[model samples]
Target chain A: MSGEVIRRARGAVAALVLVGLVVAPWVVDDYTTALLARTLALALVGVSVALLTGVAGMPTLGQTAPYAAGAYACAVVGSRVSDVGVVQLVVAAGAGALLAALIVPLVVHARGVIVLMITLAIGELVVVVLGRWRSVTGGTDGLAGVPAVRPFWGLPALASDQGRYLYALVVVATLVGAVLVLLRTRAGLVLRAGRDDETRLRASGHRVAVHLSGAHIAAGAIAGAAGSVLVVAQQYISPADFGFDTSALLLLGVVIGGTASVGGALVGAALVIAVRDWLFGVLPGHAPLVLGALFVATVYLLPTGVNRARSRLSEAAAPQPDPPAAQERATVGEVGR
Target chain B: MTAVAVGTNRIDPYLIPALDGVAYGLLVFVAASGLVLCFGVANILNLAHGLLYAIGGYTAAALLDGGWASLALALAVGVLAAAAAGVLLAGLLTPVATGSHLSQALLTFGVALAGGSLLVAGFGPDDPQVQVPATLEGSVMVAGHRYAAYRLVFIVVAAVLAAALYLVVRRTRAGMLVRAAVDDPEMVACLGVSPARIRAGVLAAAGALAGAAGVLGAPIIGPGTDTADTVLLLSLVVVVLGGLGSMAGTLLAALAIGEIQTLGVALLPAAAPFLLFAAMAAVLAARARGLAVRWRTA
Candidate 1:
C-alpha cells in the first residue's frame, strides 16, 4: 500500500476506536461500564509501559512510583480544594512527570539489568516514602475523601458511575490520540531508533538520553493521569493500589496486548482487568493460579502478543505491505533491546 | 570484629549492628549465590528463585523433627526438592531457552506468583516456622551483646559454600566448561559439549543452594505470602550490584548490602527500606555497567 493509503487507514481505525469508546458506556452494563473506566485508566499506564519498554527500549519496573505520585497528587489537591477536577488531573499528570524526571536520568545512565534494578529500587523507595510520610500521605490508611470530579468547565460533577466512566474515557482517549500523534514526531522516531541501536543513534548525533528521558517522563505523565482518574472514580487513594503487583500487571498488559502499539496496550489492559474482575466474581480464591497460567500461556502461545494475531488477521484481508522477512527482522531487532 | 568496646560511650553504636549485618549478609549470600550462578551459567534471571527459597523453608517447616539428625535430613530434603524444582522449571523454559529475557522473566514471575499462592494454599496463610536445633537455638555474647548462635552457623555454612564454589569454578574442569559456555555457548557446543545440559546442571545446583539457604535461614527469615517476592527483590539487587554471573561480586555486594540494611535500621528504621535502593542507584550512576566481572576469566 502507498503511504497515503496507510495513513488514511490508520486514521480511520483511530476514528472508529474513538467512536467505539464514546458509545461503550451506553452499550455496556453498569458494572462493565465501571470496569471499562478502570480498564482505560489502567491502559493509560500500559501506554506508558509501551512507550518506555516497547518503543524506547527501556525496561522499567518502577512505573508504580509515578502511578502513586499521580494518585496522591489528585487526592491531596482534590481534598484541599473543591471541584477543580481539570486542575487536579493536570497536577496529577505533572506530579507523575516530575517524579519521572527525578529518577529517569539516573535510570537512563545504566543499561540492561542495571537499569531494571535501579528503576525497581526507585519504585520501592516511592512505596517506602509514601508509607513512612504518614503526616502527609496518611501512611497505610491512604488518603481518602476525594470529591466528585468535574471533568470540564461546563460539565456537572461526575457523580454517577456511568458519568465517571465517560469522563475517564474522554481523558484516556485523548491521551491515546496524543500518543499516536507523538509517535509520528521526530522525538518519537528517535526514541524507537534508540531502542534498536543506541550506539548508532548516539554516533549519528541523536541525544539518546534526552529521547529516553522524554519517553520516561511521557510514560509517567500518562500513568499519573490514569492514577488521577482512578482516584476520582473510586473517591479513594491508597498505596496498595499502586503496589508492585500493579506495576507487574501493567507490564504484563503491555506485553500481552502488544507493545509498541497504542491499540495493543488498550486491549491488553482491558483483558487484564476483565479477567481479574471476572475471575474474582466466579472463582474467588483461584485468580492467581488462573492469572499465572494465562501469563505463561500468553508468553508461550503469543510470543509477540495479541498484536501478532491482529496483524495476521489484517494480513488475510490487506496483505501486510512489508514482507515476512522484514517483519521477522523487526521482531528480532525489537526483542531484548 | 568483636574488638569494639562494650560500653555505650566506647565506640560507634552501629558496630554491633554492623557485625549482625555481616551475619545477615551471609544469609543473603546463601540465598543469592544460586541465583547468580543460574544467571552466570544460563543467562536466566529466574524470578521463581524466591519460590525455590520458599519451598526450602516450607519443606523444613513441614518435615523437620527436633534434633541434629532431623536437621541434617531436612537440609538434604530441602536441597534435593529445590534442585528438582529448578530442573522442572528449566524444562518448562526449554522451549524459550534462547528467547528474549523478557519472556524468561515473565515465565519465572508467573511461576513465582502462582507457586507462591499454591504454597499458601497448601501451607495456609500463616507464616511457616522452622525450628532451629536445640544446640543452635542459644545466643552467644558478642561485644557485650547477645547474638543468635544460628546466625554464626549460617555464616560458617555460607562461607564454606562460597569458598567451595570459588574452588570449583576456579579449579575444576566442569567449572571451566561452565564459564566457557557462559562466555560463548555456541563455541562450547562446537567443541562437543552440550551447553543445555550444563545450564540445566547449573540451574539444579543453584536451586539446591537456594533450598539449603531456605532450610537453614528459615528460622530467621521464615516463609510467608510476601517472602518470595521480597527475597527475589533483594537477591536481584545483590546480583545486579555484584555483577551478573560473578560469585565473588555477589558475596561482596551481599555483605555490603547486609550491613547497610541492618545498620540503616539501627540508625533510622523508617529510612531503612530506601537505603539499599539509594545505594544501588548511587552505585549504578557511578558505574553505569554495574560491578560486573569478566565472564570466562573471572
Candidate 2:
C-alpha cells in the first residue's frame, strides 16, 4: 500500500497493456481485433478527455469537435492519397490541436457551466457545418471510403484485417505512451496543479490560463489522432457519428474508466464498448435504453471508476499487509482529484 | 434568405405570410414562457423542453383530430401532459441532479437523448401535421396579400398571457417567492417559504406553456425534428440574453429575437443559422460589460 509500490504497479500495468495491444490480434479473432481497433480509437478520445477533466479540471462535454475534425482530416487526406498514414495522422492531429487553440481563448477564462456551454456551442456549430455544408462534408451522408494507413517506406504491409488491427493498436500504444511521457514532465505537473487549484498555482507564479489552454490543445490533439484512426478503420465518417451523443458517450466512458489514468481511459472504453456490443447482440434493438441505464449506474456505483471495484476486490482477496504509507502517498498524488 | 424588401411596390404571395411572422413571434413568447420560468427558478436546463413542446403539439394534433370545440380544451390537455412530465422528472431524476449542473446536464441530456430516440421509435421520424382550428383557419387580406387570421388571434392571446404573467408575478405570493429566490437565495430561504415547492409550481406552469406552444404552433408550423431543435436553441438564446431570472428581459429579448430570426432569414437566406450564433456571440462577447452568470445548484 506504499506510494512507491503503487506508482511502480501503475507503470507495470501500463506496460502490460501496451504489450497486450501488440499481441492481441494473434490470440483474438479478427472480429474482436476490429472491435479492439474501435475500442482503441475510443480510448484515444477518452485519454484526451482524461487530460482535460482529470489533469486540468476542465470538464469539456463536447470533444466530438476535434474527434470529428481528426476524422474529417483523415477523410480529406485519404480521398487524395492511398499512402502516408503518418502524414495523414500528423495532419489530423495538428488540425485538432489548432481547433482547440481557436476555441479556447474565449472560454478559457470561465470555468464550470460557462465552459460547458461554450463547448456545447462549439459542438453544435460543428454539427451544423457537417449537416448544412453539403458540398465538402457530404452533408449527413458522411465521408466514406477512407483508405487505411498504408505501408510506408521499409515498413511491413498493413493490408490485412489483422495487419490493420495491429496498425491501430500500435498507433494508440505510441500515442498513449507519448501522453504518459508528457504528463510526467513539468508541464504535466503544472497541468495537474491547474486542475486542482489554479488560483493557488497562479499565486505561486504561473500562467494559469496559458497552461489551461495548452492542456486543451494537447487533449484535442489526442482526440483528433483517435478520430484519424477511427475514420480509416470504419471507412466512414457521418455527421451522426460526430453528434453530441458520441461526445457524451466518450465522456461517459472516461468517467467509467476513472478519468485519471491512461489505463483507466482504455478500460473505460473497453467496458463501455464491450457492454454495448454484447447487450446489443443479446437484446437486439434495446441497446440504447440499456446503455443509458448503464451510464447512470456507472456514474453512481463506480463514480470514481470501475478500477475502484477492481482494486477493492483485489485487496479483499489478497493476504493481509503491513502499513505501506509510502505507497499510499504516491497513490494520493497520482489520483489527482 | 432575402430581406423583405421594405420599399417594394410589387405584391408577392410569400410576403404576407412573412408579416404573420410577428403574430407567430408572440405565440412563441407564450410558449417559451414555461421554459423561461423553469430555467430561471430551477437553474436546471431542461433539455427535454422540446420534448414537452412536442408533447403539446401531439396533444393538440390529437384533440384537433378528435374534433375539439375550442383551442382552450386542447391547450389544457397539452398543459396537463407537460405538468405530468415535469412531476415525473422532478420525482425520478432530481435527486441525482440535486446540486451539480454537470450531473443535471448529464441526466437531462440523457433524458433528451433517450426521449428523442424513444419518440423516433414510437412515432417514426416524419414530420407530423395538424389541421388549423376552424375558427382561425381562414385568412384576411392585408397589404394586398392574404395572411392567416389565426396568427392575429394568437397575438391577441399572447398579449393577454403576457399581461396575466406580469400581474401574477407582481401580485401573487408564489410569484413573490420566485422573485425572492431569483434575487437572493439566502433571503428567500430565511423567509420560511419553501423554494423547492415553489420551483415545482413554476416548473409545472412552464411545462404547460411549452406544451401550449407545441400544440398550438404544431398546426401552423408542423412538428418534427427541426421544430424541437429550433425551440431548444431559441429558448437558450432567450434565457441567456434575458439574464436567467429577469422576466422583463425575457419578454424583450424573445420579441427582439423573434423579429431578428424572422427578418434575418427573410433578409439573408444563406446566412440563416449564423445570424443566430452571431446574436449569441454578440451577447457572449458583451459579457465583459458585467454580464455575470450566477450559477445556482440545479
Chain A (alone) TM-scores for all candidate structures: 0.85, 0.85
Candidate 1, residues B90-174, lDDT tens digits: the string is 8878887353556677787778778887888899988876788888889997767787888877778878887988898889998
Kindly list the per-residue Cα lDDT of model 2 for residues A1-337, writing each as its tens digit: 6999999998898778778778888999888887878777887888887777666766666687888888888888878864577877898898788878766754565554445555765676677767766777788888877666674656754666788777788788889889889989999999777665444576789998799888898888888888888876676788887776666777667766666676777787667767767877897655666676665555456434533222222221111122243234223332100
Score candidate 2 by TM-score against the native.
0.83
lDDT of 2: 0.68
The CAPRI classification for model 1 reads as acceptable
The candidate scoring highest on lDDT is: 1
List ranges where model 1 is wrong by over 4 Å. Answer: A1-17, A26-30, A81-83, A111-114, A152-156, A306-337, B1-16, B289-298
Q: Provide the DockQ value for model 2.
A: 0.16
